[model samples]
Target chain A: MSSDAATDIMDGTHSALRTHGYAELTMQDIADEAGLSKAALHYHFDCKHDLLLAFLDRLLARFRERISDVGGDDAADRLLSLVETVLLPPTDGEPHEFRTALLEIEAQAPYDEAYRSRLERFDEVLTEEVRSILEDGVAEGTFCDDVDPAEAASFVVTYVRGARTENVAVGTALGDSLEAFRGYVERALLAPAATSVTDGGDADDGAGDEVDGE
Target chain B: MSSDAATDIMDGTHSALRTHGYAELTMQDIADEAGLSKAALHYHFDCKHDLLLAFLDRLLARFRERISDVGGDDAADRLLSLVETVLLPPTDGEPHEFRTALLEIEAQAPYDEAYRSRLERFDEVLTEEVRSILEDGVAEGTFCDDVDPAEAASFVVTYVRGARTENVAVGTALGDSLEAFRGYVERALLAPAATSVTDGGDADDGAGDEVDGE
Candidate 1:
């Protein structure tokens, strides 16, 4: 089979997996869905796991490409752009189904080693990108001086992940949720004085107080 | 069964649920693990769903009880207290198993209606608590004049949830992670001007500049 033809078959199989979930997906189902011979499917991928890993690999590559396209004046803007890109819904003709598939794979990765490895690598790339942005912010005095870029980046990524999970929870379109999340992220990353309640304002002192009796 | 005895069995089942995931767990396993007969288990919980709901209900009660313990201050202190309480590991012997079980149930809630209801209610309570805190802060002027306690509280809860998920991911002892998360939360909650940067001098703009880049 031609390489281009094999790539198309792989894409078709990934689409099927997204719609049918991992457990219900089968080689025959993918081949039939792709209108390819079962043997031909095997020619490209040994099994479902290989195909899933490939799908994730493609996702990471796409993310890297988008990151490359995202340019900004400083770390904060760059970080925001990076987040906005992921959180925003794709415009016309963008490969959204792949994202949905990758999300499913990420949710299920904990139970699968190969999938988990792929996800860890994906996470590493994301963290690295975020870390670079944060490092820039600190150097440029755009963010807090003491902010640990890696730790802050980890929290930021986790926050986005949580927001995405929330979006998934309410069944909100990923695109719309991404917009709301951008607002939250903007506040979260803002320089401290811009939004903090400190400076002897009616600040809650850093001590344990009661929950509701006040 | 005596009310106390029934409660004991329920707690036991909930405890077992935490240590074992919902999908991988069984009533028989809970019973065996709890050292109780299947009859005793059924007498307390009609089925798994009922049992799961009970566990959630108990968690809610515990949360309310904890919240109610905060007093002797305005909303800011109370709000901080609530966060502190959440940050502190459950020292009341709630059992590490309970935390694990709660995480499992929380993870599954997105896919289950009853669990979802419980989860929504959980969020509602947290949001309300935050609103109250913000209201108090506004009245007392401890928080910023422009601060919206309700929104701040929402961000706080989301941050906590995100932190909890990360703590679980790292698989370290809960106490240490909780402390680290508490530090993060404290910093995030404070007015930005308060957190000292590594250098003695503050950044050029105490307030962050907004970049027009998207």
Candidate 2:
């Protein structure tokens, strides 16, 4: 089978997994859900784990595209862009449910080394993107110099994951959650120097809202 | 069974559950682990879910006790105390694994409504505590007036849960992982006023190393 065929099947399985969960997902189920024969399902992917990993691959590909969307000339703009993307509508299709199913799978990942590694790799890529943005921001004076790039990167990614987890668990869209979360991002991400150096200038500056883009 | 006898059996079952996860645990496993017969296990609990709920109840009771330890104090102290308690070692024969196991159960709780309600209530109570503390601080001129106690409170609890999830997935102690987490909490829970006014004056100054106390 062609790669496109394999991708299509993986996408279908990802969607089904999100809606039905891992426990309920089976080879036969994916075959039926994807409109393919059981033998054809086996022809492309070796097993369910392989198919799940493919879904994660797709998720990473899409997120990387968003990371590349940080077209702003400054670090603050880039960081804000990343946050805005996270706060925007979750990608339409199986990807959203794929995330939910992934969270469920994450619960079992401790017992499964392969799943854990996949998650760790995904986190590493995200952290690198965030760290790069922060590093550039520091160089440009757009971000506080004293900020720990590594920790800030982790914080941004972790906060996004937490926000996404809450959304998926509760079925709320990111737009609905943007205002409440903007306050959180302000405290968690903005430079303290930027806030305090100007004598309450930061309070009314609306810097947070501008980046949040709501 | 007599009340005292039932209590003893319940306690034994609870301990056993803590040591083994829900999926790996069976009535026979519980009975054997708890030094009871299959018949005795059935006499006390109808099914695994019943036993699981009882175990969750005991765990919730312990968290309540922990929450009470830092209560009625100043908002910062209360919140910081709660963070320390969560990050510190367990004081009363409570193994860290037990809490990890409880979190593991929380991951599964989404599939079951009754369990999900219990988990939601758990989050609601802690979030409320944080909100009340933030409100008090805002009134007392400690936290900024613009602080949204509800949202801030949610961030605190969610941040802690996310941290705990990391620890469990990595099989690391909270202490081992805490160095990385310090920055995240600072951003998530610290008020802007507190951060700007403090100026690293006392970052860890009086934040005692004692995590849990007898």
Candidate 3:
């Protein structure tokens, strides 16, 4: 099968996931969504699991590309960009269908070890990115020296994941969550000089809302 | 039905959740797990959703009871106890089957409005408890005065929920997560004097490991 056909089939799987969820996802539905015959879908992916695994790989790669696209020499700005990219809604303000689908896939992790391992690998990449940024910030004297980069990275990843889950599950605003996380980073993670300089003028500024545009 | 029978039925549902997950939980499996007849199980809960609703209510009530059972005059200690109760494994150190089940139920929130509302109620209760404790700590001059209790409570609740999800999803150790959270709390939430005193003697102490027993 051509790579284009596989990509088209995966796009159909994404739509199927958004509409029907993982439990109700069917090969027929995916093929129909893709505008491809069932036989053509089967030619590319032998089973629904195979299609989903490929889709997940694509999703992870897309997230990595977004991270790398963040351009800045300042570690703090890069970290903020990473956070905004992960938590903020798209610039078009469309509903987060892709993230919603990924969460549905993650729900299968407990029953399927392959899903669990794949999700873990995704988290590992995110954690490594955050850790590297924190280390850079510390070396530049922008973040506190005493804090462990790995633990801080773990906390950031956990907080963002939790906030995203809460937003998706309960209709909590992702913007509100990003603001709360920014507060934590300002007070606990950043060095004293950096905090004073960045937040000195306005103790209760609404600067967090500007993160998405950056 | 007697309350005892109801409790027993919920226990059976819990076991069913652990063994088969929510999607595959059947009345027959619940009946078999409870050692009750199918008719008897029907007497307690009309369907799987009814049984799960009852089970979720029981789980929330048990958590509230654990929070109330923490004996301490100090607000910080009470807060720590609450955190420990929520995140730490049981003293017996068995696998976290109940929490695992709760996480599974939460995944259904997006698809089922009833589940979403119930999980929101659970989170509201937890956030309220944390907010009340923080207020008490502030009043007692043990916590920072500048921080908003509601926002801090939200962050803590979000972080804990996220950490629990990560641990359940990826087989990460609950102890390490609890320790990371403790570090956040000690550094970010407590008053400076309290931090110096509570965490002064041992900067790199393995104090988090002792929370399971305390």
Candidate 4:
């Protein structure tokens, strides 16, 4: 399939998932949302599973794109921005419902290698982003020298994954967990200079919300 | 139904889940495992969903009991014991498959209030345990006074929930995460006095493995 056409289909899959959810979503529903006939949809993808895998691929691509845009004056701000992105509640709909649709698909990963492989990309991408941010922070003298970037990155990603999962499964407010993560970054990751610095003021300025962005 | 009968049914549910996994499990399978007629199974629990809720309740009760038994010389050991319990892969069976079944149930928590409510109890129990442990560590001066028990407990629980979910979804090794958590506790949770002490040496004695029992 052409790149543009593939993007269109992935968008359609998102819409159909929003409407019908993971359990009830059908190939025909996806095709309807894509504005393609059933036969045309099948011409590119063999089944709903293949199409959903493609949708996951698209989602991962978009995730990488968004993560790449995460920026601030320093590493701490950038890290919080990434957290904000992950914990972001969808503005247009019930965030819980959307996460529920996602949880259903994730539940299948253990049994389905295709789903598992695709889902693994999300964590890998996030872990890499976090590791790079930590490296940047260390190089800039914003984070502790003793800290291991790779381990801390893994821990952060694990926590992020856990925080989002708990929020969906237990109804912990997204904002609450986001704040919890912010506290962790401040206490565990930041160097004394960064936290207690006279010059670098972004972290302590109380304008964290404004800078973190929507 | 009698208490004995209820326990029997729950045990049967475990066996059935083990044999058939979550998705293919039928009420009849449960009945056969329990050595009950299908009518008896339906009499106590109306459907698989209700039965699963009851099973989760039993599981929570067991979790609390096991947590009560989690003992060590100091707060840190008890804490690691707790981690060991949470990250404990089953001894005799396919641990990943068992986790996958549990993950499948957890996936339903968002849309299913019965499951969500039941599952929420697990996190609540674990978080409370963690908070109490932190409080003990603080009172004993084994941990930093700057730490907030509630927030730290919440963070710990969230990371834990995420770790288990990622393990099932992406096949991340449980043992690897348990070690990562140990590192976090060492660097972030322990007071410097505790870490630098020459007398009380369990944490640093290289016997951490033997002390943190299975």
Q: Best-fitting candidate, measured by lDDT?
A: 4
TM-score of candidate 2 to 2 decimals: 0.80
Candidate 2 — which pairs collide? none
Alpha carbon lDDT at A114, candidate 2: 76
Which has the better lDDT: candidate 3, or candidate 4? 4
After best superposition, candidate 2 residue B118: deviation in angstroms? 0.3
Worst 10 residues of 1 chain A by lDDT: A205-214
DockQ of each: 0.14, 0.37, 0.60, 0.72
> After superposition, which runs of candidate 3 have C-alpha atoms over 4 Å from their true positions?
A89-98, A195-214, B89-94, B196-214
Q: Which number leads on DockQ?
A: 4
lDDT of 4 by residue, B179-205 (tens): 788878877777765642222454554
User: What tens digits encode model 1's per-residue C-alpha lDDT throughout B1-214?
Assistant: 5877656666677667666755567888778766788888887788878877876787788787777677534444466567567755446544445544555555455456788788777777876877787676556644445555665666566655655544443333435434444444334443443222222234244431111111
- Order the candidates by TM-score, highest first: 3, 4, 2, 1
Q: Given the true complex, what DockQ would model 4 score?
A: 0.72
lDDT, candidates in the order shown: 0.59, 0.64, 0.75, 0.80
Q: Per-residue CA lDDT of candidate 4, range A35-56, in tens? A: 8888988999999998888878
Question: How many backbone clashes does every candidate have?
Answer: 14, 0, 0, 1
Error of 3 at B132 (Å): 1.2
Prediction 1 global C-alpha lDDT: 0.59
Question: Candidates 1 and 4: which is better by DockQ?
Answer: 4
- Candidate 3 vs candidate 4: the TM-score winner is 3
Give candidate 2 regions above 4 Å deviation. Answer: A71-74, A87-90, A94-97, A167-178, A191-214, B1-19, B71-74, B92-100, B170-173, B176-214
